[model samples]
Target: MRGTWLRSAWVMALSVLIVASLATVAAAEVTTIRWLYPGGEQPVSQQTWKSQIERFAKVHPEIKVEVIDVPWDLAHDRIVNMVMAGDGPDLIQMGSRWIPEFAEMGALMPLDQYFGKEKMSLYYPGLVKTVTYKGKLYALPRAYSTQALIYRTDLIKNPPKTWDEVVTISKKIQSEHPGMYGLGIGGANHVSTLSQYFTILYTYGGRVFDEQGRLQLDSPEAVAALKRYVDFYRKDKIVPNPLEYNREQLPELFSAGRIAMFVSGPWGGRALGLPPDNDRIPYASAPVPAGPAGTATELVSDSTGIWAGTRNLKAALTFLDFITSPEEQVQRDLIGGLVPQGPTMATRPEFTKNPFFKTFIDMAPHGVPQPQPALWEPFQEVIVNMVQSATLGMVTPEQAVKQAVQELRAKGLVPAEKK
Candidate 1:
């Protein structure tokens, strides 16, 4: 009896100490948020974030969120300089490619600790992984994209499901309708071209590197991917002057009825359907076709993350949660023309019925993160050149892959394997 009573007292003492400690820690914390976003005069993202600022202020009145939407075009450089100077924002919006560079510099805070797996169940897993570094979640995607084939519904009564079908359809359509290429390759040198090429590369089981982290771009799968893309240029005779094609300009082509089907975003659907007060172009979208193994759809997204150097971490997190909450998310589709990110929000049956978004909504699960690597933006040009060389038939598919891998190694962008 005496021993039992002593043990009970000991347990009570420990519990009391833990509670007191937690209280003291809580008391020491401060509240305020500083967020930086790339600014533009008329971007939908800015408008949405601003409209909800007051509502956010109401919920966390104890915390002040200082929002800075910096000037357009130079905004990426500004954020980089800010971090270099130890003056980073408490929260920042990052492009998919930027995740790896920031993560490697230790400029981002891993959010997995605060919001555990159960909480993470709230978002698209593919998108969550995009900003994850070494299994730790670093950022949350606010808006996301999946590769989908946007088609002129009138042209493809039964949409093509294979590369061969696409070729046949393009030939038939173009032969019948001159000046209208069945498929438009917005072939200017940019992330869009590189990204489109990667979809094929991955579908063929090729990655930038092997499991050992050595350059594997010269592999059979890489050759296969490149060959398929090159055939579209050389044999298909569909894409006209790919070297001069600009993706941003391709939409205008689609709008003007110069192309039947092209790869674009859900926003394109809206733009196509409602050029000026619902002129309503007939259209539909679907997942990018399957490679032999499986289909891979790349998810391009912008994510919001807590900056590592912030003093007001708790306050910043509060804002993140608030901004991503259901209330703010309600306007997600209406405002941005972006698809839903969380299962709670994304799986709504009503959204699936919206014919324009159905195929894309079905494709959300198969999305891949834009490959995040430390200093990826700089090396992207080489990747584009490699594809351009192959498309123009300057080199064989295997040779192009080989040269790209060699350049990647020489640039030291790809990390050497740990022995």
Candidate 2:
């Protein structure tokens, strides 16, 4: 009987030990956050992000962030798929224009609770405007880009100050330099194409919406803007195969010395195989030529946003706040070849000392945000299609504008007539 009792006691002790082991294992498990970063599988960019994540882990050892490098080409569609599956990453690297679409779908968390209005002061006004939707903040802008005209200084002694001068100099350069194109232009169905057009549209005093948020695609200002943009291809004959290139192609062409003038963000230095301040190359940057109205350029910003469905909202917010702080932001900007968001980072002597960086920094204050139409994703398709139609001679610029307006109205995106 004593032997039986001993056996039973040993079994109970083992069971208790097993249970305790399981509890300890559970306690040791860290909360992991999957971050869909926009490094696009590039080794260098991924390493940078991983290093940053390691730093974040050091401070917040309780939270483990798993960085997933989503390529730029597939990021949007991949994110949409993940969100639809109801198993999206805890955090996503989002473009400024993407906030509306994601917010409309209820995929993004409204960060007002953690980051109030006072925190908004940390970023530029244009950056702030991009993240706010329906009076709610969805994301924090980390990096921003404004377009600048990069030209071959050897080809043109005087950089163009106006649109007309851009044309004349491009013509002169093309005529003088054989086997070289005058300008690098893109009209393909891509986000970059729409952005290239936005710089011109804004410069010509065209706005996508009025104060009331009505679509003004058919407005006289918008129509006029479309004409001049298409004219760069149809009449100017300056851009070769403008219909075939996209954003990435322009920078590549400029770096290869195939084009004389190319408009791109400061990040184009990566393709140039040089730093923004380096004058080793014949290329130099200038503000995009001002149109009749004044200087205008596209403000492209990519931000970090938390998924609303994530159970780890608090942890995600902590990571977001840390990454966007001035220290992390400046480090990311310098490493990523992106323009800084706040004045402190923008005016850093490092940037101010570099003429190429200085030009973009000076223009940041006057820069405008990309259109934030509710249907921005689809509207991008509409705008790119219209530009392609006009550039390829499928329709006149006026007809393209009319059709775009009609499409917008049919989609219930805009009113049928002016109110």
Tens digits of lDDT, candidate 1, 47-83: 8877777887676567777778876456678788998
- Backbone clashes, each candidate: 0, 1
Model 1 stretches with alpha carbons more than 4 Å out: 1-32, 209-216, 273-280, 415-419
Clash pairs for candidate 2: 40-71
Model 2 C-alpha lDDT per residue in residues 53-141, reported as the tens digit of each score:
88898998878888778788788888999999999999989787888789988999888888876678778888788788777889899
Error of 1 at 28 (Å): 16
Model 2 misplaced regions, further than 4 Å: 1-29, 275-281, 414-419
All candidates' TM-scores?
A: 0.85, 0.90
* Alpha-carbon deviation at 10 in model 1, angstroms: 60
